[model samples]
Structure formats: structure tokens, C-alpha cells
Target: MPGRALPVGLCPDMCPAAERDLRERERRLHRLELAPGCPGDPPRADPQRAVKEYSRPAAGKPRPPPSQLRPPPVLLATVRYLAGEVAESAGASPAEVVGFVADRLRAVRMDLALQAAGDAEATVVLEAALATLLAVVARLGPDDVRGPVDPVLLQTQVQESFGSLRRCYARGAGTRPRQAAFQGLFLLYNLGSVQALREVLQLPASLRACPALRTALAIDAAFREGNAARFFRLLRTLPYLQSCAVQGHVGLARRAALARLARALSTPKGQPLPLGFVVHLLALDGPQEARGLCQAHGLPVDEEGRVVFLRGRYAEEGRPPASACRVLVGSKLQGRTLEEVVMAEEEDEGVQAPRTMQEGDAPSPRVPGLAQTI
Candidate 1:
């Protein structure tokens, strides 16, 4: 084999030294393929696993402790401003105040979400912030505040904020009283939805017994049953903040109730219903608003200020009268500024506890003169 030349490609297999060199070359290629960034068939690896590894903190460089984390400076400032100066400002219209507050609260919420992770104190702050925001939003009626933001969008934000607050409560972040109150408000705001009622029913017996929640449940029942009389009656009993929470739905409730009335009262020869009766039934400000509402829905008003309901003539058109019944709900604020109305908790420590009812107990009597007014 030394004297005779081996086949060109067979030398490595035929000679020991050639075979050793070939083995060494193969080993070098294998090592090169395994090295970082070297061009070869990439190692089969899970992409998610790689991402997790990359995202993980480097060894010996742990994350800062939750105790060291503080809320953003802007968040603190904004909250203080909202609670103090803005709350007391008398010159700004309700819409303007709410729009500004909404913008600031949105920023505060975003900052809290980023910085409040794992920090109990910061989470509590977030709860308060959300509560304040919800309160501000609840103060405005559905059509009362209009601008770039749609009224429906504001309601959506309220729902989202309340949901976040509930999540916080589930983690034991907010006080029970505040959470209970907001839960009731949530039910009232979503009066027409069965889901809201289901959520309320699923609550603990103690929470379900809160006065606000109880009233909310009654209102929901009346609304679902299309009992306009009972719906307006129950509506008159809500506290100022609760009224704000429920005000957004008042127009819809009124429209639906008016439709029912039209269907029931309409006759071949139009029937004349007193404007005063419509006012009492809908809790409107007075005869003028009642007339407006009747006209809005295509009903005719007579010289004597009576609405003529004609069969097959009721048109489901026109906007409902703007809420003008300040005496019923808005006046309940009793000269308190919007901020005080919003930020004040009904059951603060050392304050009187909310009235709780037993399962079989009847609701407290309605304001005596309210019924007579009708």
C-alpha cells in the first residue's frame, strides 16, 4: 500500500494517519456549529423558552423590592390637585371639570398600573384613585356632558374602573364599605342587564343587605318589569352619589315607560292625558317638560296642555327632555361641592355604620310628601 497509490477518496479509510486527520476535521466542524452566531443548522429550541430566558434578570441582579417602589410623582400631584383645587373650583362647568378630571385620572391609572405591582400601599392608592374617578364620572347624566368623548364611552370607562376596583377588592386592597357601595352603584348603572343583577345576587349576604344595594335591586326589578311608577318612585329615594350613578339611565327608562303608556292609552279617537299626570309618572320637572317629552315622541299636545295619544301614531323618535328635575336628585347634594360628594365615604371609621336590613325586613318608608306630590 506504501508503494501503490490508494484510491483518491479511499486513502482516509485505508491509512490510519489519513483517517485520524479526517476525524479531527469532522470534530472541528461540529464544535463550530455549536458556537454562538456561527452559521449552520440552528439548534432546535423552543422560541418561548428562549424569550423567557432573555427576559429573566441577569444572575445576581434581582429586581428592586416592592417596598422600595413608590407611585409616580405626577400621580401623587394629580390626585392632590383633584382633591383640593379642582374640587373647590366654582368657575368651571360640570362638563369641563369632569373632562379635565377624566384626562388626569386616566394618566394616574396608567402610571399606577406600571408602578404599583406587588406594593400593597400603592395598590390602595390605586383603589382610591379609581374610586374618585368613578365618582366624578357618575356625577354627570348621560347627555349632560358631551365633547370629544361620547357619553357611552364614559360609561364604559366607569365599568372598566369598577371592574378593576373589584379585582383589587378580591385581593383585599379596598375597604369593604367602599367596595360594597361601588358594587351597588355598578348594579344601578347597568340596571337593564341581567348580568348586573346576577353579580349582585352572588354577593355575600352582608353586602347584598347594604341599603344602596337593596335599593338598586328594587330599581332593577321595577325597570325590568316596566313599572314606570315604581321605577320613578324608587329613583327618588337614591342618595346624591347613587343618583349620579343611576342618572345616565333615566332617559332610557323614561322613553321605555312613555312607550308603554302610549301603547296602553292610545285609542281610535285620541285620548287626552293630563300633562301633570305624565310629569308625576316620569318624575319630570313640570308640565312644560312633560309636554316636550310628549311632543318628542310624536304625540300632540292640546291647548289645555293635555297630551293626545292616538293609536298607531306613536313615533319612536326625538330625544327625551334634558333632565331638569334638580329637586329630586341633584339638590340632594345639599350645597356640597362635587369633590366632597364624590370623595366622601358613607361609612368612614368613627362615622355611623350604614343601615343593614335583615332578610325579611321591609324597606324603609318612602319620603312621605313625595307620593302626595304625584
Candidate 2:
């Protein structure tokens, strides 16, 4: 009676509203998984694979990830169908909306595991969530890094993995793990190629910077900031990074060419080929060097502890970020609207004033409200 507590009358009436809401949102996300393009929504454990258990220094035994609660692929693809849901509800970027929705969904996940306080499940869940969330950040953050992410719970493992990541992928060892780190993981370890990593990273990049690098500098930074599994895994891909560096540009693309040079000389993959064939090829330079390095050395991997490749798509399977709406237009006509534009019904385009460019190349009075370029 001395301390404040819920009034006796407030204790029982219905289920914990917060808990109930959490469960409901999770269920909704689950249902969305049944749709197309969402990856492994009702995730099944791989045939020969199981979630690995990690041992904490305090607890002598290994622990499994608690709340193995990865949201459905629709979570990401929500930008297609359920984006309005987030705009109506969260009203932020696709990543932010997803973050909000995921936050709520995770809340529900946490409630179920609420009693598992200070256990391995709790630690793994929190860590895995953070790692996965960063993967989302990579896909949604502003320009710089845009890449894949692998979550390794161990701090030391993160260090070791970071060493490997710098070696394997072309990157600086001391950077943050954001969009770029995630993108690198997507290509080398998870998605299996730089092309796909490019697509995902493009989701949040401001504009298309042509001829993508082997590993994004942003990625290098992220891994440094992330858990050890990422770092060590990165080390495995150094040779690929080196090859990109060696194949320098032929005078064009100063930024990209410089990035390539940095990758080659960064020193994570291995010692400089003071007299190595790869080094020699780099000196010769160009697309031919890239081709030569591959034929000569085979991407510097000798089949030791490779990431097996995950099949699911994170964005389509989970809640998409708020920014996703920018691209989700219904028809060429109305120019789709989210919450902010909800109150303003767009008028017919034909009725609008004729387009004209002013001195500053700004749209002239011919166009009144919308900003149009010549």
C-alpha cells in the first residue's frame, strides 16, 4: 500500500493490452508471409543446419538464440502492400516504418520471453536482432555504405571476423558496420555476389554511382562496429578485394578508380605481392587485370569455412522501411500519396500549367506547386 501499484480494479479486466497488441501484430506479419516474394516467412530449420549455440564466459554451456523471431519476408516487402499501414500508423521512412513495426513485433516477441531474464536466449535474441536491424539500416541509410550484414554474437569473434572481412572484401578495417557492411555480407557470404549486394544497397543510396566497388567503404566501417562473426567472415574474402584494387581504371572514373586502388593496397587480404603474380597483374591494370587475377588465383579462397548461403529475402520477407513508399506508386496518373498527401487529392496532370524552365533551370510559373526540372 505504501508504494504505488496498479489499483486492484486495474489488474484483471483484459489481457495485457500491450502484450495482446504485440501478439496481434506478429500474427499479422506472419500472415503477410504467405504472399509472394517474401522469403522463408515461416522459417524452417535447414535440413542439416540448426541455429548455432554460443557459450558466454559466465555460463559454461552454449546458448541458443532466444525469440528466434525473424519477421516474415513481407516485413520488407510491406512497401508493396502494407506500406500504407506504416504511413497510416508509424509515418516515417520505409526503414523507419519497418523499424517501428518491427519494434512492436519484437516487443511481442520479447513479452513471450520476458521471463527468460538474464539467459542465453535473451542475449542471442538481442544481439541477433541488433545485427539484423543493422542489415536493415544498410538497406535504408543515406548514401555511403550499402551492403549485407552477418551477426556474430561474440565480441572477440567480431574482431577476428572483422579481420577476415577486411581481408576477404576490399575495405578499410576500422569503419562502422552500416549499409556497406551489410551489402558486403550479402554479396560474399550471404547473397553470393556483388550484383545482388548492389541492388540491396541501392535501396538507400542517394543516387546511382556507376560501376560499384567490390566492397563498399561503408561496409568496412560497419563490420568494425558490428559483432566479431562479421569481421572474421570478412577476412575470408580479401583476395577478391585485392583483385579489384589491382585492376585499376584507365584514367576515367576518378572516385571509383581511387576506391579500387584503395582496395588493392588496403593490406587486409594479405601482404602486398611485392613479386606475386596478382601484384604483377595489378601493375598491368584494366579489365584484363581483373580477368587475369581470377584465372591466376581463383578469388583467393580455397574452400575453407565459407558462408553456406541463405535463401530468404530480408526486405520482402519482413516489414519494409518508410522510404520504400517513394517508389511504390499505383499508376503513372495520380502519383500515389501516403499520409502527408492523403488530405490533398492530386489534380489531373493535363490540367496543370505547361512546363517551362527559368534562368536557374528551376521550373517556371508554368508549373505552380510541383517542382519540375527541364
Per-prediction TM-score: 0.67, 0.22
Q: Highest TM-score: give the candidate number.
A: 1
Candidate 2 lDDT by residue in tens digits, 1-374: 23523111121211233333444445433322233343553442221111111112244543222223222221222221222343333324444434443343343233323232323323223333333322233233322122222123222232333333233223333222232433333343322235544555554443222112233333233233331222222222332221112111111122222233334333433322222222221222333433333323222312331211112211121211122111111122133433212212112111122122233332112222212211
Give me the runs in candidate 1 sitting further than 4 Å from their true place: 1-77, 87-93, 116-146, 173-175, 347-374
Flag regions of model 2 displaced more than 4 Å.
Answer: 1-93, 105-118, 141-374
C-alpha RMSD in Å of predicted model 1 compared with the true structure? 20.6
Judged by lDDT, which candidate is best? Answer: 1
For candidate 2, the TM-score is 0.22
